[model samples]
Target: MKEYKPSFLFRNAHVNTCFPTFFRKVEIEYRRQRVLLRKDDFLDFDWVEKGNSKIIVLCHGLEGSSQSHYIKAFSRYFSERSWDVLALNYRSCSKEPNPSPFFYVAGKGDEIATALKLTSEYQEVVLIGFSLGANKVLDYLGKEEKIPKNVKMGVAVSPPCDLKESSLLFSKGWNRIYEQYFLKQLKRKVIEKEKKYPNILKEIGISIEKVQKATSLVEFDHLVTSQLAGCSDAYDYYEKNSSLFHLRKIHHPTLILTALDDPMMSEHCYPREEVKNNVWLHLETPQYGGHISYASFEKEYWLEKFVFETVNQFQNRK
Candidate 1:
């Protein structure tokens, strides 16, 4: 049931990954809500609620804000259908920096849960996450022992569920291009945070210079992410936090969409056996959907349409 129809030219993995990012234009008005987390940090959530009983929460990829093309596309489609949609921006993903020195880099559900708290308790909820956001969705669902009764389903696209293995894969070959770009972006954030909270990294036993000097994803994680997450190092952070380990614990009717050719994905993240054993977890590999990129000629996209249908199916049963 998880099928995707793609445009021919976007069939190539690289093309699928890059085309929408550069060319696609989607604009939608949002009523922005700045939420204060318990830790004193604030997150920006963009809302398009149309007084609907059902709502979809959209989580974007690494360094992606609520303005990401895929997120905007999803918001527009769902909102037009009379389904409320809220896109939550991660700390520092918004216009302002969070008061906390650290940003959530791994698949921790803390921030996602915080955002969900803003929603009406009586409304049915669907959570959709892409790439790094996908990992967070899966982790949040699996790790939380007490899922809200109103939260019905979840969707994860291009999730690098196995963080350690995927980070290693991200360091090699053409993947390095993305790796470099992301590193540049993340470094800029670290600099911003450092300027706002001087010696913040030092207090945590890491230097801003060291974080800026890191070349690979693993090194950067080792310096910052691991420390922030309270792990020994990057490997430990990945080992403990990767959503792959938490899939079996998920209770909701969840869907995972991963491209077979996705650059950083490995077998650890896409285990057939795990999905087979869990009726709640549905896995769909579309041969080449290319890391959250689905090229489409139609105004109604394959990714969004399929997810809506899937969610509809689940909601009907409820």
Candidate 2:
């Protein structure tokens, strides 16, 4: 693993974390496809094809889509290198309201499995996920008894592997900003769902008013996510969905990237002990790189460059 040195321009965690949202601008042309799942739930995937045999699937974070800065940057980086890139958007995240009230959660591994099945045409497939999507990817890879032959490797960036601890940390000082930002978007989605499908809230036994009152991610999960996802409560959802406990089950080579000072994650999120015991798992903890942001003044973005370099090394080893 390469060492990640923070740039002098943005040494602070918050600055490196929040700088990409404003400073980074990347645009890539994609061919969109709507994948229909077994349960009839649909997910949208934005594909950038370079007529290559190797394909990379990119999963965005909570409330994020294919247009997210990190996804766009990574997609553009790999696409330029002639690797086919697919940015998979979770339900209701494509700026289009999904028919089902149940949205994507951290532990929804089946969705990722279905996505890989859909894109099984590629000879080589690499899974790359950020934040919540990272958790989902890790959970899926770990829990599955048999991984797809096309899946050569995986990379999870800034994943909250321990969901419960991370959720608690979100309500703490400075982290509340991210919690509020996510809650606002979640509440808006619920409201939109109610407007489009009037029976959705009724079916879930949750009201828009109750969802609006949720100021924290835990409250939102308890009231809305848990009920819709068939979990008894927020704790159950977190316990069942968190990837930390399942890391030992993973069979394929996987890289887990995280920062020590990520505002959205707690120290427990790193799972150092689990990674140490698991030969298949490689953990990279840089002192900097806030959340999904690893920006440097010298490059397009440090994270993207690092990811490309790491994946290239993995390919070379293979």
Candidate 3:
């Protein structure tokens, strides 16, 4: 493993001092904003429209809204560069309750595909996603369908590319906290879904308490998430949705940044050599940045700047 040059010293100071302002700006841009889509009731986005070309569509992780700290940070960074930045809210994430009976899953890519098509007007389209969203964007671009000419580049941050491994990781002791946190949110959504589609909810035997007490992702998916998304079972969904298998098909200029210490995912899930020969694929693994928490300073962080600088460098080159 190559040593990451310590850029955190100066960058951390700046991020710590400025992250508050940065966060405020993100809140102003993302608060209560919604972009409704025509495809599914579950689809919508939170947008911060700034520049005309070189659009960056940001997708957040599971149960994470477009207003997530990282999404906001990237929005600020991209907007300053005069780039159009869209912080897309997956189903049930935009504050306003989704009208549909279904929610989203990792690597499903429905909302991403919708957002891409919606932004077809842009000349340069760049897809950037964090965690679950990263895997989705990567998988979508890797499809044999031939990525549209407008999608100039792609970036994935701390992606859980292998669903099976990620789920297994969640079962471990320390990682169980993450599983619990996610399960709490998942159960809430399930309860909301049950209220929206009581008949369907009844058919699936979804109970709020049962889902709330679920210990594993597989259990949650099999009992509530799969049925809600119209899938057969947890295994079937995992087989169809995991993006690890699609690495070979990524043809765009793609950058994948992961941290070895991300508690949400397993170490074995990182596949370095998978896209080694692909000229467009760049994989970066830093020792820190726990699931996008790249705060290396008492306040500021070089990781955010690194992300912006790297994206800008690629954009300029393209």
Candidate 4:
């Protein structure tokens, strides 16, 4: 793996993390397709189909949608390579509030299963996920026993493999800013759901009052995510869903690329020993690059270019 030498202007971790999110924009048109998951809920996929046999399924980060900068940028990049790209919008993350009162949690790996099942008809499939979605990618790859034969490999970017350790960052230092922003959006969603489905939410043990009281992500996960996932508390939710435990069991070749300087992650995100022992898993921890930020001076960000190269290498491998 090549060492990442970020431009001097974007050397700062925070700058690398926030630059594309706030400044960069990707232009592409998508054809929307909705897949029903049970009867009450569904996942919306934004696809850039080029009539190719190879397809890539993209899973976005926390609170991200098909509209996220990374998803849009990568969707465009892969589609240009003549690969069909499908960006998944987790349950409530889609534009329409999910009919079911439940929302997405960090460890929601089954969502990836539904995505894979939908695209199983393709000749080859590649999986790429960012942040929380990266964990989901690992979760599915590591836990699922019967993945489709058409599924080729996966790439996890800026994954918080250890949810418990990463959760602690929310209350400390500059990370609190990110926590507050996400918390505000999360609380607002709870309020919206409460208004829309008071009776159903009551039965499900969620309420706007609890959401408003939760000041941090851990608290929110404990109050909402754990309850929805049927876990005892935040720690249980983290233990059951963290991708760290799943890394060793992954059967297909997968790449795990995370930044050592990512403010949202800790050393646990990099499973050096596990990857060393597991032949199918590839781990890369760059000295630079933050959260989901890998800026470059080229036409695409460093991550986009690197993922393209990585996918090509895997596709051409004997």
Q: List the candidates' TM-scores in order.
A: 0.95, 0.96, 0.85, 0.97
Candidate scoring better on TM-score of 1 and 4 = 4
For model 3, the stretches where C-alpha displacement exceeds 4 angstroms are 1-26, 31-42, 144-146, 204-209, 297-300
**Candidate order (TM-score):** 4, 2, 1, 3
Q: Quantify all predictions' global Cα lDDT against the true fold.
A: 0.85, 0.87, 0.72, 0.86
lDDT of 3 at 150: 90
Give me candidate 2's TM-score against the actual structure. Answer: 0.96
Question: Across residues 23-43, which tens digit of lDDT does each residue of candidate 4 receive?
Answer: 888898999989887798887
Model 4 root-mean-square deviation: 1.3
Candidate 2: RMSD over Cα atoms? 1.4
Clashes of each: 0, 0, 4, 0
Instruction: For residue 163, give model 2's deviation from the true position in Å.
Output: 0.4
TM-score: which is higher, 3 or 4? Answer: 4
The candidates, ranked best first by lDDT, are: 2, 4, 1, 3
lDDT of 1 by residue, 25-81 (tens): 888999999877657677889999788988999999999999998999999988988
Better of 1 and 2 by TM-score: 2
Please report the TM-score between candidate 3 and the true structure: 0.85
What tens digits encode model 3's per-residue C-alpha lDDT throughout 170-266? 8887777667877888787777766766654566466666777777788998877667666787877877788888888778888888876677767
User: Per-residue lDDT tens digits of candidate 2, residues 95-137?
Assistant: 8888877788888556678778867889989999999999988
Residue 288, model 4: lDDT of 90
